[model samples]
Target: MTELRISQKEFDLFRDFIYKEVGISLSDKKIGLVQSRLSKRLKALGLSSYDDYYYYIQDHKEEEIFHLISAISTNVTSFFREEPQWAYLRENINTIFASTRKIRIWSAACSSGEEPYSIAIFLKENLDHYKEYDIKILATDISKKVLEKAISGRYVAKDIAGLPKHILQRYFDIDKRDPQAPYAIKEDLKAQITFRMFNLVYDDFSIFKNRFDFIFCRNVMIYFDGSSQMKLVSNFHKILSENGLLFIGHSESLTRNNKEFKTVRPSIYERI
Candidate 1:
């Protein structure tokens, strides 16, 4: 039988390895988390120790390293999380609604799909009168596995508990097949959002071919250290239009690092 627990030395090595590879800093407090998440990998590889697993990952090809990240990255998300942000968007819809009839939004670091679905529902509701607007949401994440689920546009019923009844009725249909499962988002909403597996640490934004008018980057930045946060915030500013808006998580602040954006509201910034 292989030993499941990773030694402290091994944990440090793996932590440094991930940071060097992906700019994610795994603190000492996360040793248990790393062990819990990666122990399954060890068991799958039939490796007895963390050292063996580490070497395997180093020599392994792209697919194996991707699997390693998929195992460790957090994918926590839900429908209509932080209600005020949605309210904020609705309140100012007319101001940003342009003549192009095209609404472009980026759900950066969208996990398991809830956030982008929520965005789609919002557009279908508020922009219904404006037939000309082509609503498009670009939802991206580092995990290919989660991207697969996001593209499927299905959700467990409990995931929509906090969603408004009208929005729920309009955008989602109950999946009768899974009486106990969450309702799946309707095809109309799914068609408006595109799911792509992307690593924020190492992607060139030029391929997207356009600057986003609004970006919902939300909770994902908290995982990185100050430097990583700055780098991402700067990149966001660079990719946004002159007056584009950036919405981050409530707990996150950009007080010191990147000041290219002016605070329009709490956790909301506009490019200066």
Candidate 2:
């Protein structure tokens, strides 16, 4: 079998298709980029050419599109990966929770549920009145596979290393001797979050009837082009209530894209 040589034409087709579908941008020089990323799927499917694999995806809508997203997007996150943002939440939860009795928060592009679960634990600790409030966490991701794993709320020991010992013990069941299985999140923590499969590129937001208090859309925008970023920011602006906070990845910015939000600090924005 010949090593896969992703031709220039095939690369261009995929690059344009991904950008149009999900706002990702790939430069012309990224010829080997396509080969390296999509090579696994090609090998698995026993397809000789990138063109053949691309056509297979094109013929099948749901499966193909999702595979495209999985191939193109990066899902590198961990429990409280950026600790300072959680610290901000710790300092401000009282004020934020005080203003709203109904806490509706969204972890957009939430990869594998760790971030939202972390948020849930944070709320449980700080908000003594949490039981009284109508609180729900909506965690959505583009990858169906990751969403299922998230719904299971199971993680290896490494993923839970940063977690506080008490919260880990309280919120998770020990795996006994099975290192392979890891600890599973307790029913209460799992109950606090709801997982859904979502495609951020072209989905309608009208179904979300109520405005959210906080929207944590972090680390996913690095894939999108400038126009898609602007559109997503606009959508976020429309969905968040006045004075609602939007938390983005530390490397991302809404300052240039949307005027409705003013950056309070790094990675955190307040709706103006």
Candidate 3:
């Protein structure tokens, strides 16, 4: 059995470890949250204490990093989340689809597949020859667990409560045969996306030799400090094509001086 309480020394050790490994800076106020979140991990590993788990993680860094992020990071997302952004995208559909009939979008930190799947559905609904267009969505997250689920394209019916009824009818096929998944994304829609385990903080972005038309990196940067945020936004600016769009969370902003990307709308930036 493992200890439930996190000592101050243990808290500080794990806090810094998380920041260094995952780039998520935990505040003094989050000490309790950290303790609570990691307790489950501690019990699962059968470690004697937080310190033991920390050392275990260091030794098994490759395998344990995903579990660490899964325990603490907030991955709450759904289809068509933040309604304004979708409205804006649809309003500018002509300019967007015109940029390249062959569209490439990256749903960076796509939690469980809703955002990328939403992108797939939106394109199908809007584009007249979407089937002919070379549409590909690169959906990546640090957590392999979520990526597995995303690749499976399975969700409970409640996972899609926010989606429109027509969209539900058009894109999803209910699986009465399976006990686990009440609804599953159609195989063709799942094929439109390529999900992979990618660490935005730790992994190399240079492998992506191609520029993307749209990069939806929404709501995840709140965990990053300013310097980290600047580095990521600058990378986004570098990889995005001229006139390409970068959509961030409504609460987040690229407020740092002389940012290269031009602001198009709330939480939307363009590399113009």
Candidate 4:
């Protein structure tokens, strides 16, 4: 098998296409990264060149666009990637749940199942009389590939390695039969979440009829350019409940000029 190379023209075409379609700003340095990542897709499709794959995606936009985004997007996530946010949640659990027993949370850009599952676990552990409250967690991502895994609710040992023993025993079923995916999320916890495919940049936000109490768009906006980020933040503000909290990636922040939200904590914003 010969290594496929992407020309500068091909790279530029993909760069513009990806940004237009998904709001991901690819830097010049990402040419090598894009080439290496997308080459696997070309091989799978039996396409010989990056140009062929590019046009193929145009013709087959509905299905292949997901594949294109999946190929280029990095889905690095864990059960509890950020500790400060969780600690804050723990401290303010009562205040957050005071108004209503009904809780709506959107784990936007939820890579794999870890973040949503963690939310479920956290709520179950922290909330007294957990069964009395109505909890619905919407976990969505741009990649169908990750959604499939999330729906399965299965994980290998290393995937759940950071979880405490009691949490594992309480929420996960130890599957000795399947060594590959030794831990399976219990049906009760899995029932609380709904996984779907969503493109934050391109999708229609009008589809959401209900506002959310919490929106976790963590670590995802770094890929978008400034304008796209601002647009996304504004959309989040519009869809959030009156006192809703927005949690973003530690490395990301809202611009000072923006007035839709006020900084509640580091990387956390409250709807204003």
The RMSD of every model to the true structure, in order and in angstroms, is 2.3, 1.8, 1.8, 1.4
Residue 41 miss distance in model 1 (angstroms): 2.5
Off by over 4 Å in 1: 1-3, 98-100, 179-182
Compared with the true structure, the alpha-carbon lDDT of candidate 4 equals 0.92
* TM-score result, candidate 2: 0.93
Which lDDT values do the candidates have, in the order given?
0.82, 0.83, 0.86, 0.92
User: Mind sharing the TM-score for model 3?
Assistant: 0.94
Q: Which of 1 and 3 is the better model by TM-score?
A: 3
**In candidate 2, what are the lDDT values of residues 1-272, reduced to their tens digit?**
45688888899889988877766788777677678878888888888889999898888867778777777677778887677888888888888778668899999999988889888887888886888888889999988878878998988887888677898889899885877657898897788799997767678887789899999999987667777778888888889988999999988887564578988889899988
lDDT of 3 at 7: 88
Task: Give the candidate order by descending TM-score.
Answer: 4, 3, 2, 1
Worst 10 residues of 1 by lDDT: 123-132
Which candidate achieves the best TM-score against the true structure? 4
- lDDT assessment of candidate 2: 0.83
Clashing pairs counted in every model: 4, 0, 0, 0
What would the per-residue lDDT of candidate 3 be over residues 112-200, giving only the tens digit for each residue? 99999998998888776666789889999988888888888999867978777788888989776777887899988998899887777
Per-residue lDDT of candidate 4, residues 1-272 (tens digit): 65688999999999999998888999999999999999999999999999999999999999998888888888989998899999999999878887689999999999889999999999998987788899999999988888988999999988998889999999999977898788999999999999998889989999999999999999899999888898899999999999899999999999998889999999999999
Q: Which candidate do you rate higher for TM-score, 1 or 4?
A: 4
Quality of model 1 by C-alpha lDDT: 0.82
